[model samples]
Target: MRMAKIGLLLDEQAAVDKWAKQENVFAFYIREVLDHLGIPYQNLSKETASLEEIDLLITGLLNESQQALTQLLSFVEEGGTVIHLSDSPKLANWTGYKSVCGGAGYGYTPKELGHRKPVRFLKTNHWYNGEPAGWNAKSGFLVSGSPAGQILSELWTVIQAGNGKIVHCQADIPYSIVGIQQGVEPILHDGEPAPDGTAGIDDGLLKADDGFTLDWSIDRAATETGMKYFSEAHADKWREVLVHKLAELALEKGLTVPFVGRWPEGIEHIATISHDSDFNLEESADITLSLLKECGVYSTWCMIEPGYERPLYERIKQEGHELAFHYNALEAEGGLWSESEFKRQLQDLKSKADLKTVYTNKNHYTRFEGWGELFEWCEKEGIQVDQSRGPSKKGNIGFLFGTCLPYYPIAWHTENNRQYDILELGFLTQDLDHHALADTSVIDPFLEEVKRIGGVAHFLFHQLHFLEQPKVSEAFRKLVKAARANKFEFWTSKQISIWERARRKVKIEGVSASGEPNVSGAVSGANTVIWVPVPKKADLAAEAAEVRYGHLCLKKILSHKQAQTS
Candidate 1:
């Protein structure tokens, strides 16, 4: 394959040049990494480069010029690929180019409002060939319209001019772009392709530049809707594509697909339910559990347990559903408690009941703070997981989909020499908890990130919110179904027990060592304990008989399912 000569246009900002040195900055770093990888390339600022010499043009948000954009579009018309970064979509649209922009959020740092900010990942859409199922953004725009609003209406128009591709991200960079240029693609642990064009392999290594493997299920579903208008149907399809694409990328990369399994991966159906002090979750829990049992799936409930009935927790346990600590008390307290106090409170709450496994801990208003301390506390308390991190203006900033799946906390603290149990399973994307639900397209980039990092996606949901609005429920249903259809295994907190066992087995056998696990070696066919969710009315005796008598497969028991049944 012939290497394409690349051109970059940026403002006089010295930061842009500095950013170019970092391998992860996709737009700026692509030039240097390509050169190092033996791929020919060239870099020129907007002030110096001529349009004719550039095969692919990349520009910062501030350096967008109408004349320059016009010249670049002309170059694309002449069979070139112009890669615009930052807020260039606005300027490109102003120059009469039509572009599809999605995934907008508040800037990470206030200084990057209008400048080039790193986009987290790119959503798979039409126009790009072999485009990684997604891409990471270094400096993206704070879009003016909706979350998936039109930042570059005209950029899309120009994209249609020639057989060129245009990718506009409104989020943060997805993965280490530095790895991509080195021929290491980011993929889910299960060997799916990553958004950033990386592939996870069985050898536990990422193979970069796999030549664009399209996720057929995702692509076909997304293409069903016209890319022009943002319809609910279109949004649904986008979610399906995003989930499947991520899973496919993970499988391609040879990593364990988090949350979902590999074979006939459990039903992808999921529900998100929210509640406050005024309403109780008893009825909601019963109904949801019943529905999930009928579907052969599990329900993961994010509960703001305050002035509600305590029995609700038991009901969740009784129903074999997952219970997540919804930090409404923290939210209602107005961020007043110190880290020590918060940790103590969390510990106290866990002691209240046999509250399944505390797989996820989310804030009521999504206020994630003192995460370093929370993680430490979880470690000290032997809490296995904490799914509280997300893109919050108040919480730590660097955690934007950095650890989307369940992983050993890189930031855990130990009082003694003993290893503390702590895992941070952050959300894939923030749920529209309070306001009217927007298009599911907003989460496309996030789903791509999940695939790229081989992470678990803990989606947030409120029972009242879904019950009041069926659209939200439908959206949730579609996402789960799509994930399952793509071979993603749906898991509740209890199911995390199974994951814990699998993870431990991998760790014990050194399977997840720096290199690959010896699947065909001594560890082949090793029996690990796996958790399965049984219905409230499920015959516990029968279920046990099935497992003991070889009628069912058992992995591990991280939680007290036997006690609950008793």
Candidate 2:
């Protein structure tokens, strides 16, 4: 059997089960990763043609017929790759491993020294504690493979049967990625976890709140899913493992796996600074604008409607800063669902010449319970992008969709087969968490991780940061300087929005060597990123590129010099 690009096999019933029977959570993270890599993939149904053209088959919650299994085995034998998820008995049998039954939370350790660095994560399911949280930590069958097979994790094994390899991962990695979980049951009126229940169970799980008061200091479970290793900290490690495996498979077949590896214009990563104006913080705006001007950084200003100093707003626009709406959609007078006051505020903002045409918005207090309704309002109002997807009053400040990039959060509208016209730009870190700590030391690790993953460092610095917290403002300056030192591109919120929109339209063709790869359909004036995976044996001197997390990128250019063959 021969393979093409990547083939994703999803069981119809399994998809339904994981979506509805489980929760509304979809496999967004997996899709995000594929999109990030710019790897084209197609969903394989029962009626789909021969698997011969599929180079890598990622099977998810799919039950297979014996004939299908035989075909997959044949495909593997022909040097194709197969990744099976959770409790696959057939895979266990083929790989000389058996399922071990027990309570959830048992994690895997890298038995092979060669696999240790990439698989630094102890458990693939735990996110916060490095141990299982809540009941049944989403554990699965432990794979006891034969001597020939390599045990990457206690519950995962890779067996070389024929020319191809079979990867058996006994964990619900997809579920963890999508965050399908039993949320913490509210105990007291304050929405704390039930004290009488199991320890570490739902104690620190990410909760959807009405206010932006979720305790960031607490080392809570980032995910309520029983899996421990599926949290934010392990995202980079997992991506590394998958990328390495894919590269190895491609090398074995004497083929190079092409992907859009980095940020647009070949930038390694991006640093986007934005401010949300909500209260009597107009003074903060002046200071922030001054500071940003001194540093030569352009940022975004999201303001609450119905009020603002006209001079300050005009000056922000004069300085080339973006103006965005900071809506309040929560309950009471601030309830965005109420049309009477909401429309009036919208009218007021629209009447202001400086803020009238601002297309981007972030709800005051990060409110998004009625996001669907708000999206409708935004579409009707001609708002193009939204930054409302964040910690909110009740959610964690981690990657909600396992990505720092912008995406269409259309999965929430699956029932109508409708998609929100506005792009969703998720925030990375916020000042709320930093302000709580009175310093930025606690956020250093997170910043490093974002750099490691080459993800967008989208910071949400409130007006308070510039007004009340000088130290936090200093931290912000340091962060910007650090990003510059690290060679990360600085972007205004509007630029990021513009670039992400352009990125969606851009496509990555196959690898080229002669000269700059001509990328068609690129939005003129918008930076377009084209990425290619650098081989381990490739000559570094052959081209001038920025090496980021293994992939080599040519910033602000469209050129790729193929590895010279001896």
**lDDT for model 1:** 0.38
Q: For model 2, how does the per-residue alpha-carbon lDDT over 1-566 read when each residue is reduced to its tens digit?
A: 12237777765554555556434433334555566565667677552347877878777545555666777788889988887655556655555665542222322323321222222221232111122232131221222232222332334446676888877664445433333211112112223432333222243322233222222222233333221111243334455445555554554554545555456554767877778876736778788888888788888777776557677778888999888777766555445445555566666776774555667877776554433555666777777877775654223445433456555544341442134577666675577335343234424444555666676777788776677877767787887777788777878777876766655555544445522343444555535455444555556566656543343434325432221110
lDDT (Cα atoms) of all candidates against the true structure? 0.38, 0.54
Q: Among all windows of ten consecutive residues in candidate 2, which has the lowest summed lDDT?
A: 180-189
lDDT tens digits by residue: candidate 1, 449-475: 444333345565555555566566566
Q: lDDT of model 2 at residue 249?
A: 54
Supply candidate 1's per-residue lDDT for 278: 23
The alpha-carbon deviation from the true structure for residue 523 of candidate 1, after best TM-score superposition, in angstroms, is 9.4
lDDT, candidate 1, at 361 = 60
